[model samples]
Target: MTQIQNPIIPGMAPDPSIIRVGADYYIATSTFHWTPAVQIFHSTDLANWQLVGYALNHGEVDLRGTNTPAGIWAPHLSYDSRTQKYWLAYSHMQNMAGREFNSDSFAVSADSITGPWSKPIYLTSIGFDPALFHDADGKHYAAILEWETRTGYQAPGHIVIAEVDLKNGGIIGDWHRVTTGFTTRGCAEAPQLYKHNGYYYLLIAAGGTGYAHGVEIGRSQTIFGPYEPNPTGEPIITSSPQHLFSLGDPDAGHFEMFNPQSLMQKAGHGSLVHTQTDEWYVAHLMSRPLAGQKKNPLGRETSLQKMHWTADGWLEMADGSNLAKMHVDGLKDVPVHQATTQFDINDDFNNDTYDPRFMTPYRTQDAAWVNTIENPGHLRIHGHNSFFSQVNPAIMATRATSLDYTVQTKLTFHPDHYSETAGVGLYYDSNNWLYARLCQADTEDHTVLRVLQAKLGERIDHLTDEVTVPNDTAEIRLAYHQGTAQVLYRLTDTATWQALGTTLDVAYLSDEGVNGAPGEIGGFTALFNFIGSVDAHQLTSFADFDYYTVKNNLERGTHL
Candidate 1:
């Protein structure tokens, strides 16, 4: 029998909303502030998954000036077999300041999964993480977390359900308040409704998306429920199965629940699907922190666990344990054609178009700034704003999938001014990043390679090992191990790669290390390797990237 690895979809693909249409399985995840929002992955066998396309490729919504962890939230994917149309519901988190948590939810539909989706219909602004449930009798309902800001109420809020009309955005009746949580782990959100055995089951993510995160379930006879908790009154799946003292705490970092023996952490926010063979599985979000460190640089990834319905009509893990596992048994003898055990990326810039895996922050990328046709065998990016700018920056990046990995790129750039620089490095967001770029030296006339660091929005320059490049081309590489990074560069293909600066401790570029406002959680976005250009003087300066590659030392596993 084939064994499936955990994290079916890795690197910042959190809050998985999975469903099956016919014989194919599809999962949609949150993109946060990245453009082409709502990443969708398809799989035949549960072990292997591939990125098919993004649902919001066109300018469906503007993400300009979106803060860290504040754009696209959980996206629910559902197919109405009767109508033969696919529906998607997602939340656009616009603000987090003052704990306002103001968010707008919308719904869009298309005839096909990979599609020209219709314009978004406004759903509600009451909360985030909206999910659409299609009933067997042609009734549609929306379930979401109604964010509560009152002093005495629960910190996050309650899961509410209401009937909604899909054709026109209209709520049928008042929002029905369901149970806050099915267990003591009380930061309940991401409510997904499923009907099985004549019961409407409500699956929710609890434990605040931190060290104690887990998936809890409740069921009721009616759609709007005074739901009953699971018989065990505990999460069905979690990384830390032991009891946690901080049950109702709203803190995002629960250091007490950090299990030293476990490789996976923060396993919660699950969605379930029934296979054609009558086998059941749940896809949930999980995180793998760096070895011995609690900081998660890869953010939350999607993982799968085999589950079964109890004789008493309750959902339980097939293994009879609450703890999530690193390896799971495949569903029967499902044959998969293209399946790999590891994750790596290599792009040669040989095609006229860019890969869908490469993404930009905030605004949609314009062809004038980032294009491949300008340079036949290269990716030409015209520098516009600096990396700190939220408006427009010539940056093309892909998610960093592992802690021990090397990201290398060959760049050809001519920087007439000191502010005009272009190269490759790792980026967390606008306020946190590390870049080794080809820029002009203050004392010299030619271009030189320099290393710059941004920690908590403060810029630091490592000016010790600056190397001057006589030509326009250079190869730069960034190797990250554990929580540290080393930047290296060479002028020519045959030249030895020289270290640009001392090893820098980049553990702070994580979800917990990056400081957030008083009422907001720190960045939950994943680390990215990008080749970007900065032109403070003018937008005419451009950089051509010959190739980019990412190589991970470890196999795709549950730990760093």
Candidate 2:
């Protein structure tokens, strides 16, 4: 048997919705508070997945002023044979303050997976994690969590199913609750409806989204009815399989449920797919925390688990264990194919277009701000708002796919004022990030490079004595290993890299470290290595980046 490693699509890819069409397999994961929302990856072989593009690349949604964990949630991808269109359903979690859990769901369809998708049609404001199910009878349905805010009820509420009119985006009838006591684990959400062997199955993510997260399933004869939980009464796939009922707890940081034996923790929110060959697999989200800590700097990632249908028609892991594994069985006759968009990225900026992996936060990337054709061989990013703005910030970033990684970029910028700066560093959101920038010093006609840090909205200037930059050009590099980051710089092109500041503790960049609101759980998005610019002075300043390179050193043992 061939062994395939877990986390096939690593780093910041979470809440996967997988589907198989012909010989191709695709997985769509959530991208909260990030532009080009709703990440979609393709894989010929299940073991190796490559990001094709995003569904919301067009201006279908505006994430301006969106909170850290309150943008795009679980994006459900499905293809309708009747209409010959691909449908994507997702929730826009607007507010989480005071436990309101306010959300609005929408759906957009396209003829192709990566294409000019249609305008988004508003679905409902019931709750989040909306999934679309097209039945054999050519009718469509949507299942979602009906968020309960009552004083004494199940914390997150019930999984309800509704018949939806896809054309007009309206519900055919009232929502019907289909689950009751499905599993011992509580905080159930992310409902996916499927038809299998004369039964309608509902797969859910139980035990919240933390260490006790797991995949649980139920079945019923009708589309909307009382579904029976799996006979085992346990999650079919999870990192911690021990019994735990956290009904009233909506927090995503159940740190006490951490499983020490498992290398992949918080493995849940799974999407099942039957391959072209006679094989079964589940694409789910898993997290690899820091070695000695419970913080997942890489955030939730996409993993694959080989599954088999029991004789009684229940889904279970092929190994007959509830524990999730770091390595599992692969396809029998399929050869592993290398991913085109691997973890290590080196963009020379020679191409006329920017790398598809590049993404921005809180705002869309347009030719007005970021473009490559203007400079031919360099990516020119015009400054917008400062890093503290939730509206618009000119920053090009990609997901930090490994705990041990180094980011290098050569910046050619001349800041007219201290308020206008440009450089590269790590970012979690607008309120939390680390920036190494080149700006005009207090002295006349002098440029300096300095390091700035933001932790939970508090700013700290780490570099008191800044290094002066000659001709306002320098190469900035950041080496991050196991939650600590070191900023290095070289004045000349061929000069050796020298450390600029002491090692900064950045483990707080993880999901559990940055809190969004007063009562909201920690952030959902992970850390991103970004090349950003800030213009508090004026928006006329632009930064030119010659090249951007990121090398993940996890396999090489954390050597910078």
Candidate 3:
């Protein structure tokens, strides 16, 4: 059987939506507050996956002044056999400050999963976690959670099922409140509906997206019944299975013994798919919390558990337990691709389109900023806005692929005036990042490299704090040994590499580590390495990004 090392899809790939097209499988994940949203991965076997494209093009949506983790939420992808078109349903969680989580579900159609996708059409205001289920006959239904607040409630609101019109906006029929207070942990969400063996099954994510998280299943003879709970009368999949409807509530389960050491905690929020081989697997979001922490890594990534239908017709996990892990021996064998822990940061910029892994902040990146035609060998970015804004800017970055890696890039700057800046750095979030950039000194057109600190809330930049070093062309490298980060720069062809004085404590920059006052510690997403030119005086500057490569396990450290 194919053995997937834990975290088959790692680094901030959360709320995964999976669809198998022929022998190929594609998964799309959420990219909240990170522009160029909805990362898609392709896999011949579930274990080996590579980033392919993004469902949303940059500037497809406007997210100015968006809060951390508030731009885009769960996106559901489904395939229509009748039209042979890939249909996507997703929710943009526009406002979180008011705790609204007011979802505007939208739909987009693409002939191919690697889409030249059509523009999105507003589906409905159906709360969040919008899923599209197309019947064998081409009839489509949208199953979504109607999150509402009530006084003195059993945690939040109910899970409602409605038949939605794909061509039109919402369902033509009335919504049925399937379950009011499921109480499986605390909150119930991420509902996916499937029909198997003369029955309609509804899978839900319950327990507040926390350490108490779990997956609960129910079935009915009709499409939407007063759905009957599982025969066990509890969630079909849950860590600390003995407990139901509550966590740390011993009163919920009386039969099972207590356990104190569980490796996979808060494992739930899932979707089930049958492979081409007719084997069933459930893809759920799980978190790898920081050591000894019950708190999540600012992300809930996708994990899978195998399932089998019993003689009694109840869908149960193969191992009698729900927690997914490193390997499953029963399934068919899957091949492991090259065992590479390093990546190159070089760009040819020859393709008509930039790689999907390269993304800007909120709003569309100007096509003019990156020129394959105008500048054949280099990238010219006419920086219209600064990096501080969530809108238009020439900022592009990739996920921190690993914790231990060396990232270096050669940059040649053609600076015209002061106030413009360009450079690369280790970016966790907008507020919490550190790196060095080449800026044109206000007094002279000569470009001087300056190291900048992006700490949250302290608006006053300590530019004068670091001695400005002169460099018209320099090769900059960020070497991260475990938690310590050192910035080094060398003049072109120079054997001597000058260490930009001072080291940064990077352990605090991770989502599982330290969160800036305004920044939240996110999941195990990558610290991006990027190169850009910020224009100071409408001077069109070109940055010849020679190459960028990331290698993991370059060295281990003691700090973190």
Candidate 4:
């Protein structure tokens, strides 16, 4: 027997949709505001996974000026055996003003999972989290959450299903309104339909997306019908299995539902896949808060839970407990790839191309702003807007996968004006970040390094202490541990690293600390360690980065 650790895909990999084609398995996760969206991971033994590629890499969708936690949501990945094609269904959340939750759903297909993806075909504007299901009779059905804005209705709305046409992006006829949720835990969304043993099972995420999050199921004999809820009247899987009656509740962050016994919180939004040996598993999203706090800095991650179908056709955890575990049993016959290596960021800028794992927010990465071929041995990033702008910002970032990690970068930037700055730090979004950059002082011939922070839309500058750089170039490093960060810099590689600023508490950069809509949850994204440039003076200023490296301090056996 092999034991698989939780969080198969960690650090900002949420809303996982898993499918197994023959012996190979693939999982697609939501990217939110980060581009090169729709991350797809490949796995062979269910214990080890690798990020293969993304489905929406060529500007298939526009995410300009997108708000926090409101870009691409819950991307569902499925395959049709008849056409031998892969399908992806996702929602582009355009606006959430006045609780309208205006969004448009779209679908894209490819012959292979990696490349030549087709243009997005518009599916519906009725709701979000759209998923496509191919029936045995060759009929295609679409399921989505019809958002409700009225005062007295079932808060977030019901899961609606209808026949859809893939070639022409339109629904067949009317959409049947199914149950709002299987249990009293309301705020139902992310509907994934499956057929097993002559029954159509509809799995949905409920209890908002917070501490009370859970995976609920219901079944019906027909495609559209009054489905019967699971007889247990509880979620099939959740972090907190204690029963709670929260029907029609619009709040997403049920902080009171946090369970003390489990390190993994906010476990829900699952997608199921059957292994080749007839075993079952569910890939779900979960979060791990700080030691004794309710803030989640790493954001929602992907975890696997072993499942079994009962004689009554109801799905449940293999251990006969609804509470999620930190370790689960692996596949029966397949040997576990137990000792996997973690990916560390070590870009030397000597190659002609940048790392494929690097992603930018609020804009796409193109040769217009980011160029590697222009500078042979250096990554010349032309600064665009300021870090506060929800527009185009020159930032090359990677997910912060470890709780304690160090990020180092060498910058050769000569800023003539104070508005042109270049440096590296941790970033959450446009409104919340901590930056340490090199900028020009009041005089023209002097350069200085300062630390700046943005928390809940308020700017705080550490003007008390500033380090002067002699030649306008230096090596910058940020060390983060638990929930605090320290900025350090040195002019040369041989010199010792000197602290530039006092230790700052950056726990506010977590998902529960950032600002969002007036009545909704705070943020859905995690903290990212980034090397960026800000040239508000003129877009012509560019920063030459020699190398970028991220060193995780966790032991190999624990984190991997």
Candidate with maximal lDDT? 4
Q: What lDDT, from 0 to 1, does candidate 2 have?
A: 0.87
lDDT for 114 (candidate 3): 83
Tens-place lDDT digits, model 4, residues 1-560: 89998888878899999999889999999998999999999999987888889989998887889987789999999999999899999999989888898999999999988977899998899989999999888999999999998888888998999999999998999999998999999989999999999999999999987899999999999989789999999999999999999999865788889999888899999999989999999999999887788888889999999999998899999988889888999998788866434657799889878888899998999987787787777888899898888889899999887777899999989897888999998999999999999888767678898998888889898887698999889999999887899999999879999998689999988988888444345887998999889988867899989899998777733253
225 in model 4: Cα distance from truth in Å? 2.0
Q: Which candidate should be chosen as best, given TM-score against the real structure?
A: 4
lDDT of 3 by residue, 39-58 (tens): 88888777667888888874
**Per-residue lDDT of candidate 1, residues 1-560 (tens digit):** 67787777778899998989888999999998898899989888887788888999899878888877799999999888889999999999999888789999999999888888999999999898899999999999999999988888776888999999898895789999997888887888999999998999999998876788899999999999889999997899999888654444554666678878888888899999999989999999988888778888888899999999989999999988888887888878786443443457888889988777889988787888888899988999888777876767678999887778899999999999988999898888888899999999987489998988888889888888788888979999999987799998888899898887789999887776788544333777888889999999867899999998888776544333
Off by over 4 Å in 4: 339-341, 516-520, 556-560
Q: Report how far residue 54 has shifted in candidate 3, in Å.
A: 2.2
Lowest lDDT sum, 10 consecutive residues, model 1, at 335-344
Q: State the lDDT of candidate 2 residue by residue for 1-560, as single tens digits.
A: 67787778778899999998888888999998998999989888887777899999878889999977889999999999888889999999999888898999999999998867889988999999999999989999999999989888877888999999999996899999877337877888999999999999999998877888999999999999779999989899999988887667665567778999878899999899988888998888999888798878888999989999999899999998888888788888987754433778899889978889898998999999898877888999999898888899999999998878899999889888878999999999888899999988877488899988888889888658489997889999999999999999998988999998689899989877787333333777888999988888868999999999999876653311
Query: Comparing 1 and 2 by lDDT, which wins?
Result: 2
* Candidate 4 Cα RMSD (Å): 1.5
- The predicted structure with the larger lDDT, 1 or 4, is 4
Cα deviation of 168, candidate 1, in Å: 0.5
Models 1 onward score TM values of 0.97, 0.97, 0.85, 0.97
